[model samples]
Target: MLVTPLTKLLGIRVPVVQGGMQWVGLPPLVAAVSNGGGLGILTALTQPNPEALRQAIRETHKLTSKPFGVNITLLPTINPPDYEGYARAAIEEGVRIFETAGNSPGKLIRYFKQNGCIVIHKCTTIRHAKSAIRLGVDVVSVDGFECAGHPGEEDIGGLVLLARAAQELNIPYIASGGVADGRGLAAVLALGAAGANMGTRFMCTVEAPIHQNIKEKIVASNEQDTVHIFRTLHNTARVFKNKVSTEVVAIERKPGGAKFEDVRELVSGARGKQVYETGDPDYGIWSAGVSVGLIKDIPTCEELLARMEKEAEDVIDGLVKVRVEKAKL
Candidate 1:
């Protein structure tokens, strides 16, 4: 019943698109979100390599026939994976929705457009969003400072950020950062967003392939449960606050300790993957949005999306009643 530009663009019933959480965006979770009537995005880099990503796509296809996407974050690294090879693999698997983030998506944008794919480039600043619009992206997933993963250095919250996006840009955007529940969905729609992109909240779902201990940890957390690491390096990331992350932050505060090598072990992605596999919440750098505090139960993707949709409708209906009626003046 709730429709928006995002829903139509993505050909999904709900305007919700699961944020592709790294190491956690597995096939089971992606397929569940798709089967639940929303677009699910697989994390391309989560696979070992391009060939592994192709196999992951094939695995997802076996679970559900619904449309899904792949998240290809084009960030710079010492040895970057072949981003183009991953895109080609996704295309070969019939994936038309592409979520591109990090670095400039210029080359990837052109390739996706040429292939008639809908590319949603996530950006933290309005300038980048405008640049992406000019660069031929289909939609912009506006990530505010409250988001998990790379929240950019701007540190602007979603409330102000979404308004800025609505004011300055012509393209439709989905609100990210701190968005988790039906009220958040309703709030974003009122603030002129097409929809929302959620990360932490989805991690607390049954479909999420992470350990149950991790899911419960997210559920037990509140807004204060997240801490920002990598700020010392100026490539800030929001992660679940824990012994490891806390230690990382403490080290960053020490004199001459802001270098990457100083806290590399605590924030290593390799260690983070072990945390996911072993269900140790304090093992390594694990990302979570402030919305983690809002998660109270671990529901299935279908149950969560269905309830969120109903709640959004209820809120929107309430808003519709706020119109002016004839009054004696």
Candidate 2:
């Protein structure tokens, strides 16, 4: 495969990026993705403290010599959560890449650049992508409505979002959301994106730290199985359809009966931790992209990458063959 600016900037062999999934991007998982030829990312906030994040970075370094990154989500509600401290710690640990999500990165982007780390901020809309570019980020990871986590209220899909970003932004960017296979990858590339950032797809990989049961659930899911909840909070998350999420939606729709605090218990962060770690799907939160339906089997990071590359090559070649046949006519 031809190396793009994304691979060159990150110093990785492939353009694919392992999305920083909370509770899933541990040291072993991050190292595995890096070793498998993609830019692995550790979710920094998953660590209980800044010291724990430092330790995870050290462990990832011990596992692979390849490049990797750390993701820090700037949630505004957390009062003085020491986000800058975490960013400084990641820099001191020699992390070459940083993926920022959530609220405005603002000064954090300047800080990362000053520390000699390339910043890639995940944005759900073209406006946010422009903001990241204005903040001087090297790359942008555009997460469309089909992505897991907070897909924003605009609900724009990847194809339209990527094209819009390409038209408006000068900086190199990657397409995310609803991308899980080689065809998805080729489609993103053809859409003018430098590469694809995969979250749910990587979650099903063997290297992912989530329980095997969760991986199985992801594989078994179809496009119709996901539901977006918490829109009343102005924070929408795409979760696999379950009893809990269904109830959440139900409560939100009730006339003069639903309260944000009422559904808060069901969407607690601790509950998500339990579900992701213990595989107790019934009691905790399970995030999945609409692309989960397309996933049929669980594969190792290596196998997934190899298969995606081969299938993408076949797709590109097939397109060329069609063009050649047309010329003969």
Specify the highest-lDDT model's number.
Answer: 1
**What lDDT, from 0 to 1, does candidate 1 have?**
0.91
lDDT of 2 by residue, 1-329 (tens): 74788888888877899998888889888888888888899999999888899999999999999999999998858475789888888988998799999886888998988877799999998898888999989999999999998888898988789989878989899988988998888888888888889999998988888888888988877899999998876788998888889999999888875677898899888998888878877776778899998999999998898888878778877777766443564
Off by over 4 Å in 2: 325-329
How much does candidate 2 score in TM-score? 0.96
What tens digits encode model 1's per-residue C-alpha lDDT throughout 1-329?
Answer: 88899999988998899998888889999999999988999999999899999999999999999899999998678888899999999998899999999986899999999999999999999999999999999899999988999989989999999999989989899999888888899999888899999988888899898888998888778889999988888999899899999998898999876888888777888999888789999888889888887889999999999999999999988888998789988
Instruction: Please estimate how well model 2 matches the true structure, expressed as its whole-model Cα lDDT.
Output: 0.87
Q: Whose TM-score is greatest here?
A: 1
Candidate 2: residue 226 lDDT (0-100): 91
| Pairs of residues at least 3 apart in sequence or in different chains that clash in candidate 1 | none
> RMSD of each candidate?
1.1, 1.5
Clashes of each: 0, 0
Worst 10 residues of 1 by lDDT: 256-265
